[model samples]
Structures are given as structure tokens and as C-alpha cells.
Target chain A: MTSEAPTDLAIEVRGLVKRYRGGRGQDELSAVRGIDLGVRRGEVFGFLGPNGAGKTTTVRMLCTLLPITEGHATVAGVDVGRDPAEVRRRIGVALQEVGLDARQSGRELLELQCGLYRIADPAARSAELLRLVGLEDAADRLIGTYSGGMKRRLDLATALVHEPQVLFLDEPTTGLDPASRLTVWQEVRRINALGTTVFLTTQYLEEADQLCDRLAIIDDGTIVAQGTPDELKSELGSDVLTIGLDPVEHDRARDALLTLAGLDHVTDAAEGLAVYVDDAAGAVADVVRLLGDAGIRPGAIALSRPSLDDVFLASTGRRIEGGVPEMAS
Target chain B: MNETLLLARRAVREVWRIPAATIPALFIPVFFLVVNLGQVNRIFPPSTPFLHGQHYVAFQIPVSLVFAVSSATSGLAMVTDIDVGYLDKLLAAPIRRTAIVWGRLAADLARGIAVSMLVLAVGFAFGARVKSGLVGVLLLIALSAMWGVAYAGIAIAIALKTKNVQTTNASFIIFFPLLFLTPNFVPLDLLAGPLKAIARFNPVTYVITGLRDLVLFPDIHWGSLGACALTIALTGVALTALSLRALTRFSE
Candidate 1:
């Protein structure tokens, strides 16, 4: 897995690791254990994980902001360890924080960023970016005065100044309002359509499902699952029938449904019991009858296709949002 | 080079727009100068031997100039950048890392000049005159500004090393002793034995002495001026190297 060539991939990582040296009285900590990843060119690849799952750490290693303790990684066909400067030239990065100098006006900051990247005609380029981010009218206004959404958009524009081949957005819309998040999604689509590969790290399940062409779900510093949203969801090959019941009765429901036809498994859910079955339509009547024979009354029932949350639950025994594993019986 | 200039220009604009940052620094040094003159003006009359036929304000002008310009402004700004993540943005760029430090120091130079001019004006309004003439006045401003630029690297180094606002701001406190141990109050000979011995070894003494010479003497004191330039150059080299080293190891 560590030997895979990355010539055609936007980003490739093999057995990548990051370790923090401990100070006095503290033990050494490993943030990212060995992990392998391949992000195809011209696609939005989401690195999805919960907080403290090493999402930002991995992104930082790839962006050359943090050094890799071991293993090989490359961005834009350049080895990150061997030629980080070259990798930097070919990649753009917008971290979780907006990273704008609030003292400067939007136009001034963009122009300065353009100059740093050595773009020709900085003013024209700055103007073009301000328009791209829908900040043209506020170009000359200080960044301190811009709304959170405006600042995030301007930050996105700054990353696009050099037209980088690979752009890294770490939680691009993490703290944004719903409308701003949608606008960022549109911008991601627009950039990807223009042939730039995007590597986005997000904890939002909906964001990964909506924007990522493919994604890797990370848990506890390891890659637990990887695939397109549909592929991962379809792998479950079962419909989720959430049976609302008393928490104490979950084990009883699980026991009664174990012998039902088309049944895969049952897990304790937040509200009740989550029953996985090959044929939810066929298994519904059997589930109610079995629980009835056991003298348990079922409440509201919901049947739906497996969602990314379900996929995450299946892979890690936990829902991404809830961050707590449901007990399997 | 171009990247450095671009960043420096942005930093200068920050200095221009945020008058709040600079005004407080200016106020403290100017206030001290006024109060010190009020206390000691009659004692160090124009006819006093070391006064060299000039008012006490002329002798005190160089001290105020040094105090006014030596601030932790750039370091405070650097910590702010780190807090706001702007430094990370620059670090991820393809530009040379040293350019970031150079850019901040360039703004320090600009700030040093402006503050030096204001302090000089206050001295002028208070009856201080530069006997070494126009060239002396220009050199006085230039050298004061250079010292500020040199001293700024300490704060920057601290900011990069600690990456904490309070710790970085505390770097300026280290300058208090350096400023007091110099011949800031009177000529070196008039000081007490042990105090004079300590001031002799202090680098700031030469800087103050050289600047004071311009105000009191009729011509350039090449020997003291050379020592002053040499001190500023050495301090600049050492502190700048410390900051550059801190930046290189920032990720570690």
C-alpha cells in the first residue's frame, strides 16, 4: 500500500504518520497513525471525521504546515517530504480559520496575496477574485468589518489566486450559517468544474454526501472506511427500520427480531432500536409479529435507505454526529 | 525580494490604519520626557558644563527618541497573525519564510521613523536645538529608527518561540533595564562609580551618547557615531538571526 505511485492522483499518502515529541512529564503522542489515501484528480475528495479524529492533522501534513513523522505523501505529483516548496507552489490552502489580515481591505489583501504568488497584473487579478467571491462592492472595505461569510468567501478567493492545481479546504464552512454553507458548496462545485482537485476535510455528514465525489471516513486516527457515498451506503445492502421503544426494551426487541426473516442485525439507537434487514418491506410484518409474541408494543417506525450515518455506524459502530456507538445484539 | 516588499507594504498600511496601536506607545515616552524635564530643567541649565550651552530638553531628546521607538508593536502584530491564522496562510504560501520576518521589520523601520520625528518635534518645541545642524537631525532620526528596527527582532523572536500574546508582549519589559542602565540622565562622567561602570558596558549607552552628541556638539563626533552604528549593526544581526531561527523551527 505504501508503494503506490501518485503520478496521476491529486494527492497520495502511504503509511503516513505524525508524532508529537513529549515535553517534561508528558508522554509522546501520536496524532496520525499510519494511513493511506489517494485523491483522484479533478474531484472533490472529502476527508470526513469527527473532532480530534486527526482530520486537521492529516491536512496540515499534506499542506506542509506540519512535518510528517514517517511514511510518504505527495501532492501534485511531488513528494511532500522531498519537495514541500514545489508542492506548495502547486497547491492552495484555506485552513479552518479564515486566515485574513483584518487590518487590510479585501482588495488590498487579495492584491498582496496575488503579489506573493507572483501573479501578473495584481490589481486585475485581485478584482477578478473579488468578483468571483461576490465581494466586488466591498473590495475596499477593511476585512475586520466583513461578515463571517464574507471573510470565508474572501479566503476562498485568496486560495484561488494562483489557480492552483490542488486546493485544500479544511472545514471550509464549519462555522458558517446554512446559506453561507450552500454558497461555499456552489463555489466548490464551480472550482472543481474548472478542473482543480479539491481536498476538503469536514465533520458534516451532509457536506460530504453533497459535495464529495468520494470520501474516506476516519476514526481515532485511522481510516475505517472509504468509498463514494452511494457505494458505502449500498454496501450495507439493508434498509434501516428504526423502531421507537423504551431504552430498557431494546435488548428484548433485539432478541425477538433475531430469528425474523431477511434480518441482518439490530442495534440500540438513541430513540429506540435500529433493525437492519435485507428486505425492509418484507421484514416489517415479521418484526411486529415477533415483538408481539414477546408481548412488546412498538411505537412509531421509520423505514429508509441506509444513509452515510448508517454507513459510519456500520463501519465504526457509531454515528458521525452522535459520536457514540450503539450496542449491537 | 518582491514578496518581501509586498508584505512590507501591507504591514505599513496596517500601521497607518491602526493609529490606536501606535498612539499609546508614543504617549508613554512623550509623557516621561515632559515630566523629566519639569523636574530637572533648572538643575541642568544651558550654562551647566555638560549641558554644552543647551537646554535640558536637548539632552533628554535622544532618550525620548529611543524610548518612543522601541516598542513591541511588530511582535504584537505577529502574535495577532498567529492567533487569527494569517501566519499559517503565509507559511503555506510558496514564498521564502525569511521574507515574513523581513516584512515585519520593514514596517518597524517605518514606524520607528514616524515616532522619532514626533519626539524630535516635542524636543524642538521645548527649546532643544541640534548644534550639528540638518545632517545631525537627519542622522538622529535615522539612527533612532534603526535602533527600533534592531530591537524589534527580540519581540518577534519571542512571539514565534512562545506564540502567546502575553509572553510576546512581555519581551518589551526586558528593555526597561537596558534603557535605564545607559547614560540617559546625564553625561557618563557625572554618574556614580558603579553605575558608570555598568553603563560603560551597556550597548544602549553608546547609542544615546552618539545621538546626544549630535544635539550638543558643533560637528560630527565620528568616533562615537561609528561605535553607535556598530552597536546597532551587531544587535540587528544577532536578534534577526534569532527570529529567523525561530521561524525555521516554528512547525517543530
Candidate 2:
């Protein structure tokens, strides 16, 4: 309920590397390749990457779920390797996998979770958390019967029961439908508002762009880019102008857009032509006039600022969803 | 120790949530006791002094207790924990990792002891009497329960390694050969050929022989009892080491 920002740092990592045995015969698979990161107290920091990009691996290391194979990290002022138990006690984790016991009701599971942490008032805390996640009505119902979103909400609730100083959410909304994802987002915001330092990893660009104070884009087991969403987008130095034209007019539109002096670059899209220009408002008129003179009128024209997806595409040469490599089965 | 005890109590509470599964787990030993007793009474000669003049039911009762105790798959419990994500949840907790294993073992041991007591009561009703009376009966129950708890280490180790129900279930194949190869079904003196030779080395053989002595014979065989105790202790140490090793690999 407090609104004050925390002054101390909650987590710090420097050139952290984690490698696993890959390709059968004891060969190494480097999941996290020397990534540096820092999470301030009371801030919502997002780690954005495709699946298998070492986001989860990094989170696991910070939470002390997995040992650090190389580099060094500290969580809540404790070395990850030297004092893992102390780190564990100070941090809460809700993994991508929903690990709820189906047989235990929401309330019962929370009570058990509270007991595990040695909380003095487990029952009262469980009740409060159930209310926090809006699961008060179904508190006594078996978790097996809950919907995907409901389960995720309860998982979040369980992570917050002990009031840990740092909370880690790894792809917290990966499988949820749009509506459920929104609900989880709202709860995440609520949690962050309460001064808990949130270390969130998500594949959804829009989620990270909207929720994170600062974001890191990881790729190939290392961080490829890091900045605030706005700051990252500002690096592009211009707005994006997209023109949806008929397939037959694609070549003509590309030529016309490229000929324009203010336009920086032009890329063909399935929908139409995406043109990057220093000033979208100034360039749109010239682009439309040139298309009109060339007798190649576009079906639709839209201008927007660069988004996280564009930032990812610029840095990685492929979209986040497209470039991720599949892990071995 | 407090953390272990607390976790053990939680494990016991978790078992009650699955009534359907618990019902069959509790029923199998009782069913085997009843069905086997009826069949053995009809076939085996009456008042036979196979070993110290023990009746068929009395001699078979301890074997039933051993089977009941050993039959529980801590592996199944481990699989359940792995599936529900509770294993990682426990590992992430601030408590000692050993508490997770110890807690489940303690719960299984309690369940094994309770089941053993129930089987003993059923045996007593069906004309199985302990020559050493109440004290002897208590000792037999304690020893048999200890054996059950000790054997669960194997199940837990297998569970941690495989992390699958089918794999853990298949690990029980070792139990069948173990139970049958020993002097479990017949007297050690009566067992012939390779089985008789192997029974000499089977640890369960000593436990069965020890329990029979404590329950059916007027005099306790301290040597066999000591051997059974040593086997239980060594098995516990070995299985505990295996389970912990598997657990370390699990988090990796």
C-alpha cells in the first residue's frame, strides 16, 4: 500500500554465464552467455526474449534454483552461490509452469505455502492473498477445477503470501488467453505498486513495453539490447509509416517510397510497405503525392511510433517470435 | 528436526486429499493377508513345526507385514511432487533440501506402521498368536515398520532419478524377485536348489526369520534379530545417500 520507491538495489548480476550439457555426450549448451543485469528495489524490470533465449535460465540463477556455472550474481545483497538459502528466503518465484496441487483447494494450498515459509498467521495471510487475487469466492474449490487464468492468479497469490522483497515471474502469462493475460497484468501492476521489486520475463513484446520500467532483450543466451521501452524506441530516430497497397503495386510503392529524401529505409511486408522516415507527418504527404502521381494509390495508410517489436527486429534481424531456437526434446 | 517433522506432517495431510488412491493403498495388504491365509491354511499341514512349531497364519503374518511395509512406492509420491511442481517449490524454499526427503519418508513410515498394526490385528483375529505375548507383538510391529520405512528409500531414490510414474512403477520389479527369492514363501530349510543358496544371502530372509522367531517361537533369536537390525540400518544409509544424490541432480 505504500507509494515510496525503495532506495536500495534488490538484485545485481555481472557477466553471469550458465551452461548445460547439450547434444548427448557431455557437450556444453550455454543457455546464458555472460549477461549483465541489475534490478532496483520497487521497480518492475522485464527480461524480454523468445523461448530458450536464457530468460528463464537467468531467472533461475537469480532465484538460486540453478547453480551459476560462470560469472557472479547477488540477490538481496547475498551471493548466489555462497548464501543460496538466504537469497531464497528473501525472494518469491512463480515459474512459467503452474505447480499447483490439484487436490488442494486454493485456500488450502496457500495455507500450506504459508506453513512452508513459517509464517506466523498462515490462515489470515492465505485469506488476504486469496482476496488479493480475486479468488475469494473459489478459495475452497479444488485447484483442478480452476481455469488457466484463475490458476495463474492463484500462483501469483502464492508467491506473494510471504511478502518477499523480490518476486520473480518467468513468462507469467505465456499460455493464458488475452483476457486472462490482462487480468494477470493487472495483478502484476498491483504487486509492483506495493513496493515489491519485480523481475519479470515475458515473450509478449506489448506486455513488456507497457509494464516494464526498464527492459532487456536476450538472444542466443545473452542480452542483445537493454533500455527503457521508450528509450529503446527513441534510438530508431524516426516514426514508422506503413502503406497497404495492392500486391501488384508493391514494386512501384517501394520505388516511390525509397526515392523520397526524408525516408530512411523501406521494407516490404505482407500487408504492404513499411517505410521509416525522420518525420512521419512531413513524409506522409510527399509519399501519398508521389504514389498519386505514379497512379499507385495505396489501399490504406497508417503512421505510428516504433514499437518494441521494431526494436527487436532492428537488433536481432528477426522478430522475437521467429528467431527463437527450439530446445531438444 | 522441527522442519522435517513439519514437512512430514504436511505430507501426511496431502495423502488424505486423494481418497480414491488412499483407499486402494490401505486395502491391498489387508486383501493379501485374508486371501493368502485362507489358501495357506487349506494347503499346509496343521500345527507344523516348520520353524519352532509355528502355525501357518502366525508365520505368514510377519511376511504380510513386511510386504505391506515394502509395497508402498515413495517413488509414486516423488512423481506426484515432480508433476505438481511441489518438488521445485520445496527446493526453492528457505529450508534444508533434506527436509523434503525426510518429511516424505517420515510420513510413509507412519503410514507403513499404521498399516502393519492393522494387518497384525487382522492376523490376531484369524488365530495368529504371538508366543511372546503383547511385548513381543509390539517389538515385531516396530521392527517390521522400520524395515518398511527403510525400504522406501529405494523407492524415493528411483522416483527422484526417473521423475515419471511409469519408470518408478517399473522399479518395483526388483521387489517381486526379492520377495520370492528369499525364504518368504517357504521355510529357509525347505527352500531347495538356487533359491535356498540365495536365501542365505537375502537380507529379507533374516528379517522374516527374525520376525517369525519373535512372534511364533517362545524364545527370541537375538542373532537373527541383530542381523535384521543391521540390514535395516545399512539399507537406510545406502538408500538415503542414493535419494540425496538423485535430489541434487534433480535441481540441476
Candidate 3:
């Protein structure tokens, strides 16, 4: 949001905000509270969040699809609010929705996209894109006939037609099968390898950890945490031990875990408590003992190294539901 | 202009690729033309003064043309794009937003032209002839298609405002009263006093009269044609403006 954002940053935002005016008798809702971000020119930057966390709202504002309620954002060095056309010219977007026309063939849609972008020879550009997305074989087929993976690939191809400096892919693999999600991840890696700064948003934790060079985890209209996946996870500075319990007992569980030795913090997980500790092996016994002493029987108990979900829990006091890629489909 | 044309090309392609969308629109009009001629062709013979020396079918041809081309196809297409998220793709593209509405209207032009021709062909098959000859035929086609293009604005506006398939599709129902309020059954003078008064105020009456005059008369009736043209223009300007406004507000 700073006026003097370095030119090296592909996207820079300061105090970005979005609010929806509720209809008659309803109060206005703020979808995105003020947030700041600086994405470097050639890195895969992720906007990580749960549903309704304003990730899409922020992306929409930056993409100029939605007006900014307040704040400043410069995409590819052009102010999003002041000169959206230039930002659009430099940034390609594939929203959470596939945005492909079922009536048009993959080739036709690409050529149409090329023409819309004023590419001199749409035919050649479309062909090149089809090959890039490995959709050449299915290029002539109607988009309605395309498999989910094929459609997502073609959607990616459409965005790349202009060779934009920054590409925004919002949860590109949310509904994809595992194999297709991996293929899409590979495609993202390939696209990023070409020096295009990719801004991706996803609820999948592993996706952010594996794909993003850096990420910001947003929750309830605000960014709760951000960093390189390793930096963020390492910031937890301990192991995570998730103890399952009834939702009603979460408070009692939290109270019990509060005095455990080496405990850094305890956040409410969907099932129970996510207790962060210096040593999971040493603390697991204390955690169990404390819960047993509180007259509450714990359900399944699992211990693992810190993860992005842990970071989100640490920042927001609540775990992100379905945060792993394994739950995507 | 180029962006509009490109989107228009995509829209026109959708018109052909999706026959289901166009077929129902075409069918109902042709069916009415056939059934109306079957039921009333004898009652209102070519000798009926309102027939103006041509067959009753000729007198009714304009009605069918009006009916056939005045469809919710474009609006339905717009809603489909919204539902499937293709509209967002176009919105995000670095193109004039107005071009999206223009593109849809351009396809309406193409569709209206095709539908007018088929209705004319159906009229011809029913022993109807265009007295004003090929020129009249061309005028009829152009006027009908242009009217379609003009009337399409309402559907597009509704589609953009509602972004719902059922609501958008229901836009066609708004036309039923508009179509019948005119003197489609008989000449204006012969209608009941109340119906005649309402028909006199209907813009569709002018459109039908304009196209019908070409069919029943040997010369181009510029007065009726002018009123028809004026009606189409005013309707087009009003409706297109509304749809464009809707498109502008769509993202909000």
C-alpha cells in the first residue's frame, strides 16, 4: 500500500479493505479488514485462508474484479484502483471458478482469449498455449466435454495467452482428483519456472507449504500469519500434539493443558485441542495425565512436527478445517 | 470494436453449437403461425378487408416474425455465462465492459435475421406473398431482426440484474401480453373499443404494422415503416441503455 513500493515487487498492497453493503435492514459486512502484502517479482506467493476468510475478496480487489473499499494495491507496478487496465494487462487471472465456456472448444476459447488480448496471431498463440498446458489433444473438443483436469488446464492456458508478468490462480485444484491436483501443481511449478510471479490462494496447507515461496494465512477478514512455509512452521518452534475431545470440553481441555511443562500454547482444534510444545514425546504424557485428572477422556491423540495449520492455529486460536490436500476431493 | 466483435463471434458460435436454446424459441412461433392459420384462415379469408388483397397468412406473417425473433435466448445465454463464470473471464480481460453487452446484441442480430427468414419461409409455405416484393422481403427481415436486437435488451438487463436462469427465462413471458395487446387477430379499427385503444398505444403494433404493410401492399409504406423504425430505435436505446447499466453494475 506504500506509494514508494519497490519496483522489484510484482504486487504490493497496503491497508487493503473490502466491505459489502448489506441489503435492506441488514448491517454492512466487512469481508476483508486492512491487510498488507509484498509479493516479489518472480516467486510463487500464496494467499492462504479458509472459506469466507476474504482471500478471494482480496484477490478480486487486486485483480480489479471488485472495487477496493479502502486502501491501495499496485499490481505489476500499476495502482489497482487508479489504473486497473494496466494492471489487467500485466496480470492474468484464473479465478476459483474455472471461467471457461462450455460451448467453446479449448482451441476456440484460447483463440478468443488471444484476440481479446490483441495478440497478433491468435491461432499460433492458442496452439502454443495448448501445448504448454498439454491440452493439444483435447484442444478441439467442447469445453463441456472436457474432463475436470482438462478444463482446469485449458483455463490455465487461457490466462497464459498474453504471457502476463503475474498470474493469479485461486484454488486451482480445490475439486480436482489427487492425480489431477498433482498435475496442476506440476503445471504451476513449470509456469513459475518461466519467471512469472504466481499469486495463488488455497485452503490446502500442503499446497501452500509445497508450492508457495511465501504465504500469508488469512482468517475472518484478516491475515493472521505470513512467511515462508518453513519460516512460519519453524516459528511455531515446537511439535504439535492434537488431542481429540468433545467440543464442549475444549475449554476444560485447554485449562488442563495450560500448566503442562514446556507447553507453548493450546489452540482449539475442530475436534479438540491443538497443544504446541517443545517436546511432543515428553509432553504427551503430561497432556494425557492432565486431561485424565480433569475427569475428561481424550479421544485419538496424534503428535507431529509443526505445520502451516499449526501456524494458523497459533495465530488465530482455531485450526483450519480441511487444511490438508488429502481432504480436497 | 475488435473486442466486441471477438466476443460477438463467440456468442454467435454458441448460438449454433447449442441448438436446444434456439429450437424452442423457433418452434413456438411456427406452431402458433400454423395453428392460427389452420383455425382462422377460413374465418378471416383473403377477402377480409384487413387482408389488403393478400391472403390472411400474409397478414399474419409479421406476427410470427415478431414472435420468433423476440426471444429470451440472449438473456438466457447471459445468465448461463454468469452461472458458469465465463462472464468473469470476459470481465477480467482487458477489454471494454460495454463490449460484453454489445457482443450479446450482435449475436441477437444474427439470430434475429435467421429467425425472421424462417418465419418468412413458413409464411410463404402457407400461401402468403410479400406484395412489396424482394425489397419488402429484405425490409421485413431487417426490421424484424433489428426489433429482435432491440427487444433483447430487456432480457439481457434482466439476466444481468437477476443472474438467475428461471428469472431470466421468465422474461419471455413479459412479451406474451405485449404481443397480444397489438392487433394480431384483426385490424385495429375492428378490435373492441378497449382493446383497440390499448393496441393503438402498443409499440409492437407499429412493428407488426410496419412489417405487415410490406407484405400486403405493393409499395413501400414509408409512414408505417418510419413509425416501425422509430419504435425499434426508441425501444433499442432504452433497453440497450438499461442492459449496459446492468453490465456496469454487475461486478458490484
TM-score of each: 0.98, 0.92, 0.92
Output the better candidate (1/2) by lDDT.
Answer: 1
Rank the models by TM-score, top first. Answer: 1, 3, 2
Pick out the ten consecutive residues of candidate 2 chain A with the lowest summed lDDT: A320-329
Number of the predicted model whose DockQ against the real structure is largest: 1
lDDT of 1 by residue, A73-177 (tens): 989888888888888889999999899999999999998999999998989999998888899999989999999999999999999999999999999998999
Per-residue lDDT for A13-84 in model 3, tens only? 999989999999999999999999999999999999889999999988999999999998999888888888
Best by lDDT: 1
Best candidate, TM-score-wise? Answer: 1
Reference-based lDDT, residue A263, model 2: 70
The candidate 2 chain B region of ten consecutive residues with least summed lDDT is: B17-26
| Better by TM-score, candidate 3 or 2 | 3
Q: Model 1 lDDT vs. the true structure? A: 0.92
Tens-digit lDDT string for candidate 1 (B1-252): 299998899889889999999999999989999999999998888999999999999999999998888899999999999989999999999999999999999999999999999999999999899999999999999999999999999999999999999998888788889899988998899899999999999999999999999999999999999999999999999999999999999988
For all candidates, what are the clash counts?
A: 0, 0, 2
In angstroms, the error of model 1 at A35 is 0.8
Model 2: chain A TM-score against the true structure: 0.91
Q: Residue A29 deviation, candidate 3, in Å?
A: 1.0
